[model samples]
Target: MKRRTAREKALQALFQIDISSTEPSAAIEHVLEGERSDDYLSKLVNGVIEHLDEIDQLIKAHLEKWSLERLATVDRNLLRIAVFELKYEHDEVPEKVVLDEAIEIAKLYGDDQSSKFINGVLSKVKQHLF
Candidate 1:
């Protein structure tokens, strides 16, 4: 699968896990709809799950007034996936690409303000990480 498609699937799976407390494999399967799972997709979901506390901490720190739980499901999971990539996959994916991809994904799946909100928060995260 294309990385973008994998990312979208990962976002959906993570969103499910976050909102419904679904099992990761089940969530991933539900999102895949019988399509073969991609390695990147698994890595994303599992990585996010494994590092959830740290990822949420990073998000919580950068959030201006909003808390992590208050974030929309799509917005929250998008940030998690992007933050996972930014933290662990930076050697493979540029921070700019990660940020841009997160913004684009947020635009597609998030509410009207989601893109800007994600961008702002992620930019802060990027600065902090680098």
Candidate 2:
């Protein structure tokens, strides 16, 4: 099987966290097992969770009319993963690359407009932060 991207793995872990009220570390451990577990994915999931509050704050700051609570769980987590990569994990991935991957993931797992929503939110974040 082709190796999944870190963003993809992070999305899954965040989805798990959203659905279950589990701790982020526990969720990361659960998701990072079997064939899915890998260094990149583990790092991304951990990194995002490590700075979740900061990432959420950045997301909320740029969200305009939408509250983070109002966003679809998948989209909210997608933005978290993207923002985490953009701000803190810059050494591992480029900003545009992370944003593009987030959009694609949102399209696949999020709502019909998830890609657009993620793009808009991440674009504002990028402008404000970078």
Candidate 3:
């Protein structure tokens, strides 16, 4: 799968895991809907799950006034996926690409403000990391 598609699927799966407390494999399978499983998609979901606390802490640290829990479900999980890539997949994916992808995905799946909100927070994250 393309990385974009993988990210989208990962966001969906993570959103499920966040909202319903679904098992990771079950969430991934539900998102795949009989399509072939993807390595990147699995990596994203599992990576986010594995480092959830760290990822959340990173986001929480960057957030201006917003608590992690106050974030919309889509925004929160999408941030987790992007932050995972930014932290763990830095050698594989450029930070700019990760930020851009997160913004685009936010535009598609989040409120009108979500893309801007994601961009702002992730830019801070990139600065801190780099």
Candidate 4:
């Protein structure tokens, strides 16, 4: 599977975890069935969950006037995945690539403003982290 496809899966898994409050392991297993699973996608999903607090903090810091709870769940988690890729997975992925993929995902699964919102927040994250 392509990277964007993997990201879409990861986004869905994250969304599932958020909506159902299910365990990550089960959530991942449930989502990965019938789909190709790879180390990169696995790492992305698990890493985002593992570092959720830190990721959320970064997003929370960048989003002025919009709290994490107030943001749409899809937009919030999409930012989390992109930020995680930008920060912790830098060796394997480039910042622009992560941001681009995120913007595409946002356009598909998020509100009309999601792409702009994600870009703005991630730009701030890139400035601080890189």
Taking all chains together, each candidate's TM-score versus the true structure is 0.98, 0.87, 0.99, 0.95
Error of 1 at 38 (Å): 0.5
Pairs with backbone N, CA or C atoms under 3 Å apart (clashes), candidate 4: none
Which portions of model 3 show Cα errors greater than 4 Å? none
| lDDT, candidate 4, 1-130, per-residue tens | 7788889888988999998897877777787886656676788889999999999998888988888999898998899899999989899899999999999999999989999999999999999997
TM-score of 1: 0.98
Q: Pick the candidate with the highest lDDT.
A: 3
lDDT of 2 by residue, 1-130 (tens): 2224656767888889778867777776776675545676766777877888999999999987889999888888889888988898777678888888888888889989999989998999999977
Q: Candidate 2: which pairs clash?
A: none
Candidate 1 residue lDDT tens string, 35-76: 997999999999999999999999999999999989998999
Pairs with steric clashes in candidate 3: none
Q: Which residue runs of candidate 2 sit more than 4 Å off their true CA positions?
A: 1-4
lDDT over C-alpha atoms for residue 22 of model 3: 98
Clash pairs detected, candidate 1: none
Lowest summed lDDT over 10 consecutive residues: which window, candidate 1? Answer: 11-20
